[model samples]
Target: MENSLNSIFISLYAQRIQVLFAVIGVTITCLVLYCYRKRKPGICGNLRFSKVAYNSITVDWDRACYTTHYRVFLRKPLEGEKWRSFKTKNDTCSFTIKNLPINTNFVFSVCACNGTVQGPLCKESEVISTQNLAFKMKGISILREETLPNYIPVYDVPFRVERNGQLKVRKVTIGDYPKGGAHQVKSILFVSIPHSGHTTHLQGVMNFIFGVSTKDDFRLGFSSDITKKSDEYKNWATVYQFVEYEGGRLDKPLTLVDIPRMHGPKKEQLMMIHEQLKYILELYEQRLDCICFVGPANSNNLSPEEIDFLESIMYLFPNDQSSDLSTDISCFFTFADAGPACLENGLKSSSVKNFKSYFVNWSAFFRETNEFSDSFWNMNIKSLDNFFNHLNASKPKTLRLTLEGEPPAPQKKENVWKLQPEVKEDVANLQMTKTNGENFIDNKTKLTYNLQFFVYNGGNQTN
Candidate 1:
């Protein structure tokens, strides 16, 4: 009886031990599943470098669900350096790494973390090279008046073309207008930097708008070979007049003034061109419809000369209080060979108020077809049609011709011609004193008065 009782006790103990073991196994499995659930969020997605500077970079990534935070790891792949880690808060999606070496290639990866559990790392980002800070430091240095000897107002010097002969002005009647009919008038000024293909583009514009071939029109007086004598082209501002008609009735009479390239060897010559342009506009006695700047579509940034030209335009045509009188500024880009990125960069870098830019890939299209081909002419017509349509839809502001006493402040004094209304009386008084042979004012004041008056009166000789 004692043996049987011991066996029963052993059997009961064995069954109890088996049950305890099963419970322990189930508890371990449950713990494992819980730990896995905490780490199942995911690695960050779409990791990219948002901004890159000389010594710093900003990395951004999409947020993951159930993520408490993100950890970014950066390293120089070329140097085989150990990764440097940075942690961000749960709401943060971007991290900026600073004090990094410039002009170095960098790669980065990001991972998500839920409290203590970390998720898998994302695919590494493409290598990005930091910028060279030295290029940013280099800037255009301006020469001061004191640095130049015998510095005189640029307007005091006559244009080489004016001295050689009367500047050529051509007029043509375009459109189908019935004789003895009233017509509206519109004027546009075209300005550009050197080597921007301004003349060719202007010829295309004239052909498109007026259906007149300006290429061989001797009356237009455009340089026969601008490439061979670019310097001569810069010495004169070619002017043209086009009278428009619609349905046998007179319409807008368009005056297209092709200003000389705003860049040249002598700063004085550039200023002279600017002043002469102002004089020409004053003679119009009407507001300009647009001042279009022609440039290459591949340009990513404006040169110092281009910037100066833009600032001069702002001074010449200030924003009037009336919306109707505000000058419409536009940029025309020719030969879009570099693609949209360059165009976007150009627009972003332009300092003009109304950032309207138009472009045509004429060079590219022409390369595939002959000049006499229908497609070549159609392309030019279509591009210009779109540009004009946009201009009409936008209700381009009219540019007032009268020079204001004060213009928008300029970065360089040489870029603008400042005038005061009181100067008119002062100039009259100075002239009277000079006639009387009396020293009414000091030489410095007398010269200032004469210079200011000279520019104020459209660079004309005052009586």
Candidate 2:
């Protein structure tokens, strides 16, 4: 009996050992399959063009499965030619190739990537040609309407003047007197950061000048249809156009809509803003004839970095405050209170008081009239005047425009398209130097790059 019991126990132990071995064999097989099985990122699909601009083309593609990112290759079709590789984040489906040589053809291809390893080169590719449309061809001319409306449009009247060698604000006035009166006005946009009282002060100016209280009668928002609202609002609606930005808001300012979400230091944020501003200016270039930049004195609470950024913008577009009649855009730097008290105390006490010496001799545009107290409009006009002096010194030669009230002259559209003179230099560098096979800049590098191209061009290049 004891021998039979021992035999049973041995049989059970052997069975258990065999089952454990079987489980281990299955696990090992799975592990081997997972390691060696094809781990390629999904194949790239149709590459298409979303937009073709004067010096750039926006390329888009269908996202590949399991792709951590996409690698872009630019090739100038030739025998045994290698592609110029670029890259975009996995979530980014489109990339804009900027600073491209005009009137040239290039083939573009995309491949999926898994971490550092890229999948097979996409079989599908797209052929694109860059063209300088702004320079090569004339845009369709828009006709101005001949029939005149009965009401005097606010925009018809220019509110810019050269005062004591500074660019100063003029009272918002009618361009002409109404013969059979009951005037009409067109749309106007008040561009400024919030809490500087630009809206409230502009309201006072409009009411005093127009002789009717339309303080609450304006539309608020950015719109492509400023001309459409002329008939609806008659004339007063134009003076009430105020688009608000920044003031106790955690969200981004409306002016920063074109900029991408940013990380890193404050300087990075300013740089991105600068780029987006350039893009915005490009989009509205042709339509900027009547545009104005109105910045109030109290809004001068700009940080040193912010001041530098603004100064760069002024250098890029010095004609922002051009008083020329044929000017495409004008910049208006105003005081918080346009009265006498603010004028004296302003230059001496404002946040920009220390830096007010920069704008000394430019035109001084004021906001106060007889209806409002000169004391009520307390602003640092002198400091602002000095500020314009500095602007005059740093202003670039290429950006200068013929002053308004002076003769109209031919100006190059290229200047508007090119934000800075260095763009050409950067492009020339890219073409002159041949990239070795390791031209691909890894996504991890915390480097600033141009919007259209991924290559580093020394310091940060504006859009």
Candidate 3:
């Protein structure tokens, strides 16, 4: 009797457990179907934006629980630009119409969904049109002027060491071969610009200074930082720093060569740099063979005479915003040829009276039948080797005008024409050339460039 009773109890308990599990599974299935069928109608929450456009507000939707994508529609509130939509086979719930012109009224709607079904859009999100709305742009970042063409050099600054503990150069953050020289010191300038070239030169210097000779000493500068501008300069040459401080970063010299014309920098920036060099040069004894200016070579900022004095060191690197720092400053006021390296045998650029500015048409492309491509002109100095014999800082001006573009009007016959308000070049400027071969000194006292402006239409003979 006891055995029979025990068997009946165990069977009843097993049946109850099975029924309980069955009920729980059904409940879960019901919930899954409810969520799937809910179509997940995303929240528009009445489209919102930082600002309203014309009469419309932006649309926003929730992307939660979405598998595939979303869709956006714009309407004229009634018959607008015809339900225009953005395809979103993927998941997205937000869309912005950035160029929605000003002073227009429009309505926009958006919705999101799973691959199986789409949830209904809640409240058209936001209706937007930029009518009567005050269009105020957000704050924009103003880049430092250093970011411009006058690129600053990269740096690998040693903890500003001193001869007797006097800091010769400030701790900072810091290119190429070139013409005309003496003593054959086998000197290669590792230069630095205020912003660009310094890093490269520093790296070059470090490798040589701590290379095989001090192979084990490499661990010292292990903590020293070097950028590309400084890396190329290691050990090959001495470095000097001239920049003081501009917003904490070094304030490298400004040059006219990069600016090209008065449009380059404000009249004040020229004076600022002129005064800067005047003061900076005072720190050093005029001795180094080359005062490697690792900076831009354009004469738009510096005068022809000023640049000649700077190059009085050696190798006459056309651009060396990257000044050097070395104990031995021996060579001073020596001339190594500083003209265009590629232009040695022939003229590279021909001036054209085409645009208001003197259009320098390079001969390498025109004469060689080389099709000019944008990428070609963007190359470094080596890429430009075929065209420059080294840029002639004091080359005589010959207006080589192309017969293309607008028809040549005959009213202009002067060799140099004054620039008009519409154009950037000043054609009326006098043609100034350097006198006294290697010792050209600028007595102008003013930090201004005399652009040898010329009239393209008329020959110099008439002007």
Candidate 4:
């Protein structure tokens, strides 16, 4: 009986050993398979998304450097939503699971593939418990260096969209007038004409005459149009024609509209300038000796004909305040054009007194002519501060037609259509190098000067 029992026990023990080995073999196979599976990143990029309530989630690898295809699988709730697994290639780094009914937690992992070859899924996908993941979102960080000043309008959108929105914005004038006007009854501010000197010169004169700005602005002018209402409370104080926009100072910000107008020609450029000068004269008409102010020589860009034409304008509106701001205004002449230079270019005849410079003493012109006063430094006159001085001494009146009051009436329709003279040539006594002195210029500069004046004065001058 003992022998038989021993045999049975031995057989059973051997069976048990075989079964244990088979189980170990299966476990090893499963471990190897898990190790070989590949996966991909479930969340992508440095950007933060808005808060939302969701179960399963996916991501895109559209950033630089990543090229391999991936398959994603979520383990449990990583933080926010309930996690779930999904499939995607390198081409499709994004996915959407159709069903995620429970609010269970999860972890996610991605599997990378190279077409024929499959890789292992990532280990321990992050937890994404729907209950634990809060719905609230954190605020995003703003890039301070990239943002514009607080005063300017700003919005969060595509760059193009933001640009369009800015274009549509209308300025809301604060503190005072939505539209401002020229302060005086008349003004004589000079606006830029073409082919003028560089901004360095113009700006220097502008600052000297206008003074440092109290507040830098796009322009100094009056309202474009104002229709006075019977109800003064409702109506504006004054209406004015639009003048040239002054533009930003040397150091300041510029708007888009200003950007082009400052550098490019506008439809109303010439007209606007004319209107500005006219407005200024109107504002300070009675306050000064002259209603007009002309910058002498224009740094030598203007030709004799051009200067003569400018003088004629003085004659055209002889009655305008610009015509006479001097004492005993008749036979106008003065020492204003005297040159103090040691070496006079002897270019005096061009600076002779005329009907426009009528206020200046005729003797002054003769003296300067004899001396050949050519340096602008010596010839400049002290500007008349307030025309009141001359106005008080001699109550000057608007110069009326001393000659044919009304020029011969226009001929007819055909005559009206004939090109009217916009600019007049200086056709007067032409002198030799003696009184007027000869024009001094090298070949290159002469051509440049000639072409420039021709465009403006049509090649004309007067002695």
Model 1, 14-125: lDDT tens digits are 9999999999999999997677657666768898888876678999999886677889898888655898898886648899988886457889999888777788899999
Better of 2 and 4 by lDDT: 2
Of the candidates shown, which would achieve the greatest TM-score relative to the real structure?
A: 1
Question: How many clashes show up per model?
Answer: 0, 44, 111, 65
When summed lDDT is taken over every stretch of 10 residues in candidate 4, the lowest stretch is 132-141
Higher-TM-score candidate of 1 and 2: 1
lDDT to native, each model = 0.58, 0.41, 0.32, 0.31
lDDT of 2 by residue, 1-463 (tens): 9999999999999999999999999999998656533467777888898887546788888888766788888877777888888888654778888887655678888888877667887764656776432212111212233323431122222222221112111122222233454322222223333233444334333323222211222211112232232333221212221121111111111111111222245444434434434333333341122223344443423333433333333333335455232222223445434323223232222122122221111111222133432333223333433423433343222222322222222222532344244456657777766453234454324333243244445445555
Q: What ranking of all candidate models by TM-score puts the best one first?
A: 1, 2, 3, 4
Candidate 3: stretches off by over 4 Å? 1-8, 31-43, 49-59, 62-70, 74-80, 86-107, 112-142, 145-463
lDDT per residue (tens digit) for residues 48-94 in model 3:
55455433445565555544576776766664357777656567555
Question: For residues 1-463, could you state the per-residue lDDT of candidate 4 as single tens digits?
Answer: 9999999999999999999999999899888555443322233332221221334344333332222455555544435655454556444556544334233544555555644354544454335543211110001111222333322111111111111121221121201121365322222222122333212222222222222222221111111121122342121111121121222111111111101011123223323323323432343342223332222222333343443333333333454445431212211122224333111111122332331221111122112223433232122212222232332344333323333322222223432233122112112233343335444433568778777877787667633
Residue 398, candidate 2: C-alpha displacement in angstroms: 32
Better of 1 and 4 by TM-score: 1
Which pairs of residues collide in model 1?
Answer: none
Question: lDDT of candidate 1 vs native?
Answer: 0.58
lDDT of 3 at 250: 13
**Candidate 1: Cα lDDT at 58:** 95
